[model samples]
Target: MDSLRHHPIRFHVTHWSDDPFSRGAYSSLLPGGTPEHRRSLGEVLDGKLVLAGEACNPVAPAMTHGAWNDGLRAARIAIEAGARRVLVIGAGFAGLAAARHLREAGIECVVLEARDRLGGRVHSIALGPVWVDEGAAWLQQFNDNPLAIHARQLGLPLRETDFGQPLAAAADGTLPDIDAAWEALRAGIDRSLPLADGVARYLESRDEAVRRATRFALDANLILEACLPLESLSVDALDEEGVGAGDRFLPQGYSQLVAHLAEGLDIRLNRPATAIDWSGDQVRVADESADFCICTVPIGVLRDIHFNPPLPPAQQNALDHLGMGQLEKVVLQFDERWWPVSPSGYLRWYDTPASFGEWLDLTDAVGTPTVAGLIAADALERVFAGRSDEEIALVACEALQAWADALRRL
Candidate 1:
């Protein structure tokens, strides 16, 4: 390692799990769980209520545009049910999209959000002149994404992220071609077995370094993407499909798309709907009665709202079975780029053995002079546990500095 070290001029760390409205980043699949659970969660209850969100969607569960699609789907379903007035809970992509769709259909729809802002998990903040996303950053699978379609319609510029290419470094500045191994990964599966078990079994024949590297690859890709601990990650997770292969970066920020979808909607911010009484013909949420209710509340905190007569056993079971995974971002913006400039949009340093598994080079993506590291599953809890923001930043910077030093030597 060399003497070259750098620290960011400014940074923003997110703790989405700590947020009351969004208990976790996204809904995950656990061992012995089926994707049908999501379909069940998306199902309308008693023809009077609908649960719509990314979690509820089986096709594209964690995507922002998926939430938007679900919202639109919910609105259509409600309209089909002859609903004149609808009350939408949560002003995220799903809720806002549903409200907009309903309004366009000449139906009265009011969106009630817990937070003062729009776009639930799609949060963004201004970093100088650049708008950086603190929550959902990438418009994953852009070509097929509905949100991407909207963004294009609105004339918002999007930069393509080359997720296929990535830079890697070890403590000795040696990086193995783990990408090949990852692509060739095959796990012997059974319903009782978790992803961890299969990975361990597969790595048993490899050397210690190879095993560690594979684990790192899994963490940086699969585990981080799922936001679930290895032991809990479902073996059936491989069955899930994304919108497409296009990964896009929004320079104007993810919120711009959210804003576009939210135009001309009855959105009431900071009005947390505590209860939804759907026992009668019409549903009454927070004292306002509506002919139909579309609850796009994140599945992580779905139980926070009191449902009168209780949700159906199938819906409750789906909520229970579906795992809510937590993944947080630590975004650092520097005065100048300290990291190496390369075509690779992602950077991963295993030199620290393991701290931050994956880093997105915003500098490369949109000339932000910034990088975002994702910490998920076990690492997320361990790193943040008993650590203040200052402490976390110190350690995080130390990891980056180590990586920089190693890369400098190379």
Candidate 2:
């Protein structure tokens, strides 16, 4: 905390774990699971009820665009089925997209959101003059992503982010040859080896210095990007779905995309649906009844909702198999930018892989003197469990200071 005393403006930390509406950050496929599980989960129930969310999207689960695409898919299905009106639960990207597409198709729809806000996991708040995204911020695969296309159509300014070349800095300023280690890891992955086990075995065969750097890079990347522990991630899935070429960010914030989709849609905030009944001819969400119902709630939230007559055995099984990944971010605004002014976006700490392993430079992205520290999975749980805002801010500032000190030594 003393490190940040020199330059301070206003700081805020948003912990999604404490959010009752979300319960967790996003979805992640457990080991021995395929994208087919998500596809099966998206299957329509009773011909009048449908599931539409990131969890249902097989192509890109756990992404805002995935939720948006799934909503569009469900909306198309409802339209083809001759449904006049549809009830959408949750006002996140999925729910908003479904309602917007349905409205465009001339079908009436209503969206019920548990929280007062419109964006579910895509929250953007103003820190003084600049807007910073507290949730889903980046638009991965900008060239092909529909969300990116929509952003362009809406004339939203998108700046290319340096996700490919993240600064790998060590505390003592003596970094190892991580490139060679990464190559060896990739070779092992190509041979169809298990992620955690294979990486561990591969590191043991290498020199001590090389092994340490390799292990740090792999673990840091996995935790920082995947938001899951190395053991929990699937090697096959990772290899199959290779990292996107690049990523783009909205300078203003990602909330613009949600706001754009919400235009002309009937979205009711603070209307949480505790019960859903789709057994009969008409589908009912709580007290309100509609011809068709599209549930876009997250998997974490779905487990809690009471479904009358119970959901199909397959759907229930899918819920049991999939897991939610925990990720936390602490954003601190400074009076002036003290970090490097390079185009690079990320600073990965090799030493503090368990605490704040990664720091994102928002100066170029949002033009604000702000940096966001990211922690994921078990590390996030350990560090942020029941911690107050002051405690979190102190830890975040100290992590930033460590990186700053490392840069100075270099």
Candidate 3:
């Protein structure tokens, strides 16, 4: 980890979080990424270079493991073509995976990350007795996932989550029966999944009834997801993309796993790739170095960086059309354990994003009376767009208080 220094020192490291080179960690599509932009980005810029990042993965985007897989996949293509001096831009999972693959294949590679440490959004902060994940935390489906396999092979500990049953409460002095609500919600999701999948296939085929049928299935899935409302998302979008319904919690945190995956690699911390000079045969990176470079920077970073020739009008337009899913998780701590013990978790409706979380019990799992998390998206701009953590917490407390009062009455 080095301070911001262009004045060449013993170890001058600078993170992209602050550096102008890379604006952020991973690329988040901001309602501007158009289909054409994605197509153009995937085109390989005249066949010499390839793009790799979480955004590139359609199924599991924005996850550490997916980015690593993308990097490895890209590297395999590069190596097959006999790339000698390969340069990996970004030191997170993507860069680390690319470096590992290249090194294992006997190819010379160097990873450059615009951060002090490797793990991008997979950050871990010290909580109480153990370091809990402040960022990505979860291992969903250990059966076929590569990360789970690696974790098992390395003998790392795994923790199973208690997602079997969750609590339910209302804001208006009424609490719903937990067992019944969960059963209904679970059944709803099971019935809606196949319908949603069929809708997607229908939409892809351009059926005349696609519009209405897609809406029906999507609306149903939204109820299952316990979103603010079913109408917030577009039917087409819902059919095209499904939510991460099968999520599992990881005790060690995704960042720890990233660190483990990043050991023994040539990562240049804090060096952001400001301007990519891709005008020549050898892709010139960072406005100077001429060599084949792998751009693993997130899409959000691209929104700010200046592409040497300026991204094409089509690409720029596509960037403008693409949108990022709204997803945020907040953890809260309560003074007293007011939540009921039976399948403890709550889902409530709120006017703001901060109020989305009903209640969750972390007493047994995390060993704290913390309320755990409030997961929501889309409503973010309206709820927490400009609010402070204290303000958000106050809103959460108020919501929880309302829920508690309702429970007591019941």
Candidate 4:
């Protein structure tokens, strides 16, 4: 649409995870000790020192909405204690949200950000003639997501993603029979429901139907394909009965929401907190100014940075043990529409190495027909880190070609 031409203003975004203050965007935990590590890392040294991040949230950890909720909770706790002046660190959604909540409660507050911009990891980039989301693009599970309410209030239009005919490819230069496989898989997934309700429908004997259905629902291959392992993501999390995974997006930018939230607030940009010194009732932060501190930095930063008097030994251990994985978004623009056979926006190519992930068409999602992205985690770190954009584009193009060949077989 090129609104910048008409509106005379354009949306800009940058990543907070790469910033020194924010080691990474969202929090992701390894398999074991996640619960214990969460409790210890976020345990308040005292009522004066409070911690809030997406990681601190048990129910909805590693999500923007979760981080916002945690910030509000932390601020409320501080406010309840009769703290006159409060400071929120990091100008991302969490910090901005915390500040907004504090302001609503009539508490004096300020937000500190390491980067020059807000939005944290929600970076929106322009690809050729169109703008595309480079980070945290999806507002997943919109039913329970309060962000939608805020979006509506801001007059932001939301739309659902259309599943027009997804294509699949294999890494071995072969295309798995995607349609047939998906049909079988869907049927398998669907048939489990009756088995799930067998106890209620046919109560002839003690039925273990629920247990069997639960096992099938938590299939290993399904979880792997979804990126997370079976155990980390629950079947209940997927079903989310009644709660629609009605994912919605903002046309302007996800960062626009962050910018909108930051308006009418005191936010200091390019201020990275090095250390936290909470000796007295009031916490002190290390920056250009030795002023009141509210440490709202990401957990990854907290783990790496030094703190005076040292965190509790157990907390320190948790910080040391907690590891952050490298998640990357590689975008490419095609010279021509090579994907002729399938017209879907989503394409899953299983044939590529683990480092190479499924190909996604950002055209429908972001109004950019020529653009797409490869969503890979730590697996692609070695490949993506040192490569030039042109090289990356070539690799992506070749991957797509291989994927297309595989699809032809199917």
Number of backbone-clashing residue pairs for each candidate, in the order shown:
0, 0, 23, 5
Ranked candidates (TM-score, high to low) = 1, 2, 4, 3
Residue 305 displacement (Å), model 4: 2.7
- Residues 301-376, candidate 3: write the lDDT tens digits: 7676566667666556655644443444455554446555635333343221234543334455656555544444
lDDT per model vs. reference: 0.80, 0.79, 0.53, 0.57
For model 4, how does the per-residue alpha-carbon lDDT over 228-301 read when each residue is reduced to its tens digit?
43333323323212111566666566877887888899888887777777766566665332223456677778
- For candidate 1, the 10 contiguous residues with the lowest summed lDDT are 184-193
The deviation in Å at residue 159 for candidate 4 is: 3.4
User: Which residue segments of model 4 deviate by more than 4 Å?
Assistant: 1-19, 162-166, 173-244, 287-293, 340-344
lDDT of 1 by residue, 95-159 (tens): 98899899989999889999999999998898765778989988987777878887888898887
> Which prediction has more favorable lDDT, 3 or 4?
4
After aligning candidate 3 to the native by TM-score, how far in Å is the CA of 386 from where it should be? 5.4
lDDT (Cα) of model 3: 0.53
Reference-based lDDT, residue 357, model 4 = 47
- Candidate 1 colliding pairs: none
TM-score quality measure for candidate 3: 0.71
Model 1: residue 163 alpha-carbon error in angstroms = 0.6
Residue-wise lDDT of candidate 2 within 69-176, one digit each (tens)? 999999988987789989999999889889988988889898999999899999889988888899887887666688888899999988776766777567755877
Largest lDDT belongs to which candidate? 1
Estimate the lDDT of model 1: 0.80
